[model samples]
Target: MGVYDKMGKVTKATRSRAEEIVDYVASKGYKLTRIWGMGSSGSEHPTGRALDFMITGPGLGMVVGNLIASYLWKNRKRLGVKWVIWDEHIRSTSPGKSGRWEDYRGASKHEDHVHVFFGTGAYVAPPVAGGGGGSAVKVVDLSQLIEAAERDTDRKQGGTTPGAADDVKIVEAALKAEGLLSARYARDGSFGSLTVKAYSKWQESKAGGSYRGKDSDGIPGRKSLERLGKRNGFKVRS
Candidate 1:
């Protein structure tokens, strides 16, 4: 089985995000590698919030005529996820900014995994300029985030506010970094109140590496992203 194939069970967020992503992919004639029917939403992308997808398949396009991987490749300017990692199938747009791509993962571990999720609110993100991988990778870890949500309803990750559509990657480059967690636990970057609580919890558990939380000012720094890049295995290039 592949990395994604081993995904124990799909979440509602991943499923919702995939629905929107697959629609656009179909235009390019690329087949979806995994149909995350049960995949729930996470902090990266909270429930009901759809987003671009991460490339889990071998390639976005290249098999046939319509298989021209150029669809995502050509529209690179609009999708930010590609700019951060450089994948075709796993594409995503900034939260709130519909149809606009920001690729915030940056040159971090998130560069490896695609975050098509919603809110969690709080995040720390990695420091890789132009890296869409922010501090919300934790959202993908549904189990951990779910526990945090029990305490708060809204996200604390600090983002464009609920139902705003403005997304924040809040990733670094890896999946293990707690700095990458999301309150709602998705990858779309919606950020809510609950996300904040999760981030604090993560901070308390950490030992060093200069822990920094989200700032509504919308300024992502470097030290904050250090672990972020390593998470996605992009530290070398980042």
Candidate 2:
């Protein structure tokens, strides 16, 4: 099976990275399932710069997850990874710095998948399977990488209060980021029925409840707002 076989629409750079990861995993004697690509969201996925590889069976363990995440983090520069989210932690290379794995409170929690986002204008040169003219390749052991990643501090979940027009706009942006709201929502810092409907849809989708339900109501409460803000990487303020 080819890497791009079932993968949806993504940019060439993202495809290149996905191909490399797929080949590497296969070479390590692992079976890869779905690799999702584009969706109608403000996230990198819609921009063709993100890919989600669903992990299953033995690959669902934290050790394996950390291994893959650590390998990508170690070679983020060459791999063009803007950030990586696996299990419930996130690591980003946008600021050219490395930090502890921070908690990611998205509805998915990415427990079933590994998400990778490529940096803007960054690309990973394709691997040469049998070519003889390349430099020595470093082999990263799964056990070693897992241990290293585990040593990092488990960062806390981040969020801010919501009580102003800016807060509403943040919520709107986050909803758009997750593909929950269409462009029609306008994100005009005004919370209208459209925003309520969109947010309620999102809530129902994540929490499996009705929009009018106490938990999924269109109102932007603390917990729901925090989840949306953290999931979409938005700055929520009071």
Candidate 3:
């Protein structure tokens, strides 16, 4: 393909980054090759701003360095960036490149490419196995927590997070809601599979109710919430 060949699309925010990365590589005396490109903001693709780089000519991932990782690890604090895997089911922070990288082992498809995320760095790791609060005791803004619950994701794409919570927490809460013999809710607030399933169920249950939540794509919408308010003896507007 020509240089004009589309490697991938990206968020308008990353345009500078993408260009900088590409230019950085080109500056190294290498040619841009075809790489698997996903995420789109231009072509005006749906979803939020994102970049898709389809590097080719050379084998995939033949770049000089792990650009995304480098950015995350190096500038994590400066850029206010967070960490997720290149291709793993679970969303988590890298433990300084040597920690246990977690994911949804069975149903993950990030095998080919890594996903560097931005815009919403809202996932917190779940509390360790013990009852001790430790880092998990931190109070999360319920509003942000609900927003994470509303996101939908699957084999097609990674979940879009307005605000991400710990995948572990999401599982816990879903299980909590589900209780024994049922999947629990992700109390930690991370939107994992269990939470997604639970959210889907909640949305379905509310569809016909006077409280239609959001677009009901599983994201909590306003109507459903207002009804919840009324149930709690709070006034609800039509």
Candidate 4:
């Protein structure tokens, strides 16, 4: 199935890694199906750290699986891959080496899919260099926006001050990173109606009961921004 459908079975860390792997492999021209599967009792699947990718289409076989698995092993540290099982064999980070392919012996023997597990404290991939045709900026940190907001707050208390355009740009960047807003949404540093709509939609998705009704009224308040930061793997202070 689609990656989104399986995301609820795994932690956000696992979902991010799976999305990256799916995108990387798809760019190389491989069709993937199903990411989350309930493994046997006590398996990593049940713990939300494991995913399975089923490969379909002709001319794809063990050699293809080997190539995919090898690529994952090569980038294990960066991807926080704990282990990978494919074509009846498995390699893991536990030994910090790619072990020889032994007989998997489990059901399906992983002959049709590649399974990956994330390690504790999995790493999140940073934005790609030259992404968005060199026009799209990287995700903005909430702290930077907070600092600017504080400045704007101070200016407002003293005298009539212009709106915080920079804050809007930062929030737009965050929204773009989370796929809540399109790049064309104009990171022009203005908290216009468009920003409000986008921010409100994002808040609705979180729907943690803490920010509802007027609190979810489209303003980029501290609580919503903090939640957004945490969801995107940023460390935010309490």
Tens-place lDDT digits, model 1, residues 120-224 = 332223333444754332223332222333332344443333322222333311222343342235444443443443344434334324345442111222433
Worst 10 residues of 1 by lDDT: 80-89
Local distance difference test, each candidate: 0.36, 0.59, 0.41, 0.62
For model 3, residues 51-134, the per-residue Cα lDDT tens digits are 334433464453443554454445444333444344444343544544345654544344544444444322112223425633
lDDT of 2 by residue, 163-197 (tens): 23344555555565455555445335555656666
Q: Residue 63 of model 4: what lDDT?
A: 62
* Superposed model 4: Cα runs more than 4 Å off: 1-8, 39-42, 57-64, 95-108, 126-238
**Candidate 4 local lDDT, 198-220, one digit each (tens):** 77777777532256787776755
Instruction: Tell me each candidate's TM-score.
Output: 0.26, 0.48, 0.33, 0.54
Candidate 1 TM-score over all chains jointly? 0.26
| Index of the highest-lDDT prediction | 4
Query: Which residue runs does candidate 3 get wrong by more than 4 Å?
Result: 1-10, 27-29, 34-45, 59-67, 78-80, 87-100, 104-111, 120-238
**Candidates, ranked, TM-score:** 4, 2, 3, 1
* Off by more than 4 A, model 2: 1-6, 40-42, 57-64, 96-98, 126-238
| Pairwise lDDT winner, candidates 1 and 2 | 2
